[model samples]
Target: MYGCEWDDETGATNGFFQDGYDGEDFLSLDLKEMRWISPVQQGFLTVQKWNKDTANTEYQKQYLSTVCIEWLQKYLQYGKSSLQKTVPPHVSLLQKSSSSPVTCHATGFYPNEVKISWMRNDEDHDEDVDLGELLPNEDGTFQKMSTIRVTPDELKKNQFSCVVEHQGKTIKKTLTDDSLPIGIIVGALAAVVLLVVISVVVFKVYQKKKGFKPVSASDDGSNSSAHSDAKA
Candidate 1:
């Protein structure tokens, strides 16, 4: 296999080639350090090493130098744009924490740089807001939440809004008393259904384990017939 590993944060990179599993030391490079730690840096040196000859380690030095330069140029030119593209976040109301507490959820956005806060009657409200951390999404995006407690009286007197800033855009989602996010509602219902199903399965398993059996329809009918005959 032939490929390179580059770390954007520390500017560390390595380029290497391997012939096969349990193969001879072929070509390896610490491109960032500009050092040859093991194996020959050139294909010819690799061939020489494989054949047990005195190998020229820098035989591929010029080529590796060129690769390093190109790598730096790519990072300088297109690194930020390659994996740093922005995606607008979806904002919605989460399930309320209490009768008065409402949470605003923002999800599925890249870059993870987001601002979440509350707005009361078109004014910035921060003292009561509880902002959550940037949680990673399975899709490599991010999710976050911010909650605020507003009483029914205050909600009736003033409008409450969650302002989310991400991807160079501002999203203002209004908080409502009884409305939960559609995703949250569906997830909750699915969870409850799953719990009920699991409970039933567990109950059946426990009953079987205890040698308890359910009465069949015929057995119930037989018992009813015996009871009627006894009364007669």
Candidate 2:
């Protein structure tokens, strides 16, 4: 394997060139000394032969120090935008049921580095907390979840919150009835109302198409005679 490393802050660069035989180190280049180093006796002869070629050694040193560094810089410049980008996460507190643990889920964040913890009354709480593994999202972002087990009585007596630290920002979600699936209930009710409205509209359209009219108690027998003539 051979590669170059660059330190942007210090402007320092280094390179390495190595060869292996049968899963053992055979020959390696020492960039500082401009020489080939061999760890085993079998490679001593090959190392001696390579060391005698001063012209080639000088060429190798120049290529590793200058040419390799230039290529590395170009690659870094091409990928700078994607490598340095940061995206904040969307945080949510979720619970399946009253007896289940509350999960704090954070998703759609970039860079994959985050911290999740629990707090009680503004203080850190670690008991009965489970930290989930970092997962990848389909959009090239990341997601994570942390769950805390607490009783309903304890939640009502104290303020419990989930804290998420990501991309230099902090998000806190408090445990409350709002965290439950209330939105689902509202959506279901809305669907039912919509269905009732549609049914009423259809019924009115059918009545209109069939030439139906409201019959009042005071209507004369003329309306009944007209209906009988139409049926005939």
Estimate the TM-score for candidate 2: 0.58
Clashing pairs in 2: none
User: Per-residue lDDT tens digits of candidate 2, residues 1-232?
Assistant: 8888889999998989999999999999998988999999999998999999989888888888899999989988999898768999999887767667888999999899999999999999999999999999999999999989988878878899999998789999888743555445567799999999999899889999999876654568987777666669
Model 1 lDDT tens row, 69-187: 57765776776774768888999786534354687999998889999988888998986778888899988899999888777777767888999998779999886655654656778
On a 0 to 100 scale, what is the lDDT of residue 173 in model 2? Answer: 85
Candidate 2, poorest ten consecutive residues by summed lDDT = 177-186
* Segments in model 2 whose C-alpha atoms lie over 4 Å from true places: 1-7, 10-69, 177-232
Off-target runs (Cα >4 Å) in candidate 1 are 1-70, 76-81, 97-100, 178-188, 195-232
| True-structure Cα RMSD, model 2 | 10.1
Task: Report per-prediction Cα RMSD to one decimal.
Answer: 12.1, 10.1
Among these predictions, the greatest lDDT belongs to 2
lDDT of each: 0.72, 0.88
